[model samples]
Target: MATPTPTTDAPFGLDPSGRPLSDKSKVAAGLLGIFLGGLGIGRFYTGHTKIGVLQLVVSVVTLGLGGLWGFIDGIVRLAGSAPTDAQGRVLR
Candidate 1:
C-alpha cells in the first residue's frame, strides 16, 4: 500500500476553486471589540453577523454585560489568535 502525498498545486489557505479567501484585520477587529464590543462591531467586522447580532441582543438585555465578552475577545485577538472570518479566512 502506498501513502498519499500532500499536493502543492495551489497556495495555502485557498479553496479548491483556486480563489483566494478574503482576509480580516486582527488589529482592527481587536480595537472594534475592545471599544464597541457591546454593539458587536468586532464580530460584524469579522463577518460573524449571527454572533454579532446575538452579542448586541445580549448587551441590550444585560445592560452592557456583553461588553465584557467582547473585551475578552479583543484580548484574545490582540494576543495573536488570528481568528478567521465566516468564510474561514484567517485574519491578517
Candidate 2:
C-alpha cells in the first residue's frame, strides 16, 4: 500500500503565509454574503472586520444598492473562487 503524503509534502500548494490551511468554510461565508451581505456578515465571519464594516457602510450609504456588490461577492465565494481568509489561507 502507498503511504499518503503529508500536508507539508503536498505538491504545488501552500497558503501565502506558508502555514497550515484555514478552518474557515467558504460555503458558510458565501451563505452569509448572499443572505446578509449588506450587513457584511460574511466578511466578519472570515475575519475581515474592516471590509465587513465597509460593506455595511456602503450598503447603508447606497440605500442597499451596494448590497449587489456583496451578493456578487457571495456568488463568487460559492463558485470556489473566493479570496483567502484574514490569515491568508484559502477557505475550506
Candidate 3:
C-alpha cells in the first residue's frame, strides 16, 4: 500500500499533529504595541524577536520615533492586516 502525502493547504500556524504551533494572541499583541510599542513588546509577543529587537534599537536611536512604527503595526494587526507571525503562523 502507498502512503498518502500530506496536503500543503493546511492552515498557517497548525502543526502536523493538527494542533496550533503557537498560541500568540492578536489582541494582546495590539494592546502591547499601543501601550509598550517603544520597546517592541508586541513584536516579541508575536514571535518576531529579531524585529522586536530591531524596533527597540531603532526607537532608541530615533528618540522614540520607532514607537510610531509599532503603533502603526499594532493598528494594522488589530485591523487584521498583520495576522501572521515570522514563522508564518497565524495569530489567534
Q: What is the lDDT of residue 36 in candidate 3?
A: 86
Question: In each prediction, how many residue pairs overlap at the backbone (N, C-alpha, C within less than 3 A)?
Answer: 0, 0, 0
Model 1: CA > 4 A from native: 1-21
Query: For candidate 3, lDDT tens digit of each residue in 12-70?
Result: 34544344444677898889988888899999998899989988999999999878989
Worst 10 residues of 3 by lDDT: 3-12
Better of 1 and 2 by TM-score: 2
Candidates in order: C-alpha RMSD to true structure? 6.9, 4.9, 6.5
- lDDT for model 3, please: 0.78
**What tens-digit string does per-residue lDDT give for candidate 2 at 1-92?**
44433375433345544544556888999999999999999999999999999999999999999998789889888997546789777786
Q: Which candidate is the best by lDDT?
A: 2
Clashing pairs in 1: none
* Model 1 per-residue lDDT tens digits across residues 5-92: 3345323345444343345778899999999988999999999999999889999999989789888888788886446778776676
Q: Lowest summed-lDDT stretch of 10 residues in model 1? A: 3-12
Cα lDDT listed for each candidate? 0.77, 0.81, 0.78
